[model samples]
Target: MSKYDPLSGHLRRQREDELELTFAEIERILGAMLPKGAARQQWWANTTDPHTSHVQRKSWRGAGYDAFLIAGKERVRFKRVR
Candidate 1:
């Protein structure tokens, strides 16, 4: 049997609901990951509901982008296209 085993399948099934990435950090990382002049966007806010004011009860969406709730840390990873 091959020694290399892919973890993506396992990780995907056991995925957590939250992640964290700093704006600058993600930007830099994505920048390096993506080519120059690629369009990159980010959105963030307190993971609380405006109406209920309950923590972990709300989330906001950004146009042309997807959002992830990263608990405990303030960072995320993303992809961009040129």
Candidate 2:
């Protein structure tokens, strides 16, 4: 199981269309610290290409959500995909 599986499960249980979480909060959910790359917007890109898919990307996408970085906020907004 990927370390991000917990994040996927968390997102799957959410009913909100849009959920915003601080980086610290996400780290709490994952029970680990985020990589430095998380500070880069590209790290949150919804890359669907399997060859390039990372565990973090797979987590949110699998849960029918897309993640967007909240600039200057140290947070991310997860929007449920219709």
Candidate 3:
């Protein structure tokens, strides 16, 4: 069996299943919410503290801020906060 086959049984037993998004749907949302080209690119490239969602670029201090919104796996919708 394939490597993925072993995980299939476990994955199937999960309380929640993966959600699929169509390319068109993703494009539409990004088009409306994301800032133009360069800004959007910069945002995704930056990684911050996953817990506080604070950016730590250039310093280890907890002063940096999140530049984008994201939804946790258990979250039903994306919440924008800065």
Candidate 4:
């Protein structure tokens, strides 16, 4: 599977209302450790606008998903917008 497949698979299995996932859950799904800043708000920013170096995470957008921080970085919600 590709590095992004885990997240893509999870999104594929999601119900219409089943959005949002914890950062830990995402890390587990990826089967690997995330970057130190993975839990930071800037890590998941909509970078399609201004370019950013955190391009690896753009995988979520490639799969039609977007993330929003909740509970001050305790968790993140992966919402499918497309």
Superposed on all Cα atoms, the candidates' RMSDs to the truth, in angstroms, are 14.2, 0.9, 16.1, 2.8
> Highest lDDT: which candidate?
2
Ranking of candidates on TM-score, top first: 2, 4, 1, 3
Instruction: Report lDDT per candidate.
Output: 0.31, 0.93, 0.30, 0.71
**Model 2 accuracy (lDDT, Cα):** 0.93
Residue range 1-82, candidate 1, lDDT tens digits = 1111111222233234433346455445334342222232223333333465422112121111224435435444322111
What stretches of model 2 exceed 4 Å from their correct place? none
| Residue 77 miss distance in model 4 (angstroms) | 0.9
The clash count for each model shown is 8, 0, 0, 0
lDDT-superior candidate, 2 or 4: 2
Give the candidate number with the greatest TM-score: 2
In model 1, what are the clashing residue pairs, if there are any?
Answer: 18-69, 18-70, 19-70, 20-75, 21-74, 21-75, 21-76, 22-75
TM-score of each model, in listed order: 0.23, 0.94, 0.21, 0.71
Residue 75 shift from truth in candidate 2, angstroms: 0.5
Q: What TM-score does model 4 achieve against the real structure?
A: 0.71
